[model samples]
Target: MRLRYTTLVVDDYDAAITFFVDVLGFELVEDSPATTSTTGAAKRWVVVRPPGADTGLLLARADGERQRAAVGDQFAGRVGHFLEVDDAAAEYERLVALGVEFEGPPRVEAYGTVAVFRDVAGNRWDLLSGP
Candidate 1:
């Protein structure tokens, strides 16, 4: 069986959509009305994925206090995601031009070129290039 979507808690749906689709060049796979399974609260089933990617991110809006608190800290302040790109330097520059926050400039690592950047939700991700 193939893996499908990974849930990403966000402060807002539209904002997250914009960040992933517009800023990060991900495609909007789906965005439709939905409801919370626990309380039947209104929500949206929003999914986005990188171009040609098999896995997609399901953007779920923070539902309550605990979830809200976990929005950007899903990984507990670590680099929880790695975004593989063909050209790390170019992608890093492009993301910076789009106002994305980077912890530092891109540096060459033993494996490849890498840079740390934060998503709109404040989750850290590594922009990596190479095998």
Candidate 2:
């Protein structure tokens, strides 16, 4: 079976949304409502998908204690997920030009040219070019 969607926990909902939509050019597939608990605090859960791709992203909440701990561990140099692109170098350059900072330039790996970058919330993601 083909792969489906992947979720990435992010701290700032609006910032993450803008980064994916404005910088990376992903479109919003689903705009989840702001959920609330008995305390009446609103929560956010947004999802976006890459252009021309059926697989969507689940922008999970990253506020509660559990989410905060999870996100902290991930941002502390743990890879949460990767996104495969047609040309890693080209995409890397494009994102860099868009003001998206990369930890380092792209390098050739066993699979292909791969680069790592942090989202607004310090979430690490690898841009990979499949072999």
On residues 1-131, what C-alpha lDDT tens digit does candidate 2 reach at each position? 87677777777778888988999889987776686565656776688888888888788767678877776356568766687899999999999999987889999988888999877667788989976
- The 10 consecutive residues of candidate 2 with the worst lDDT sum are 72-81
Model 2: per-residue Cα lDDT at residue 47:
81
Tell me model 1's lDDT, rounded to 2 decimals. 0.96
TM-score of 2: 0.80
Candidate RMSDs in order? 0.8, 2.6
In candidate 1 the C-alpha lDDT for residue 101 amounts to 99
The sequence of per-residue lDDT tens digits that candidate 1 reaches over residues 8-58 is 999999999999999999999999999999999999999999999999999
Candidate 1 runs further than 4 Å off: none
**lDDT of the candidates, in the order given:** 0.96, 0.80
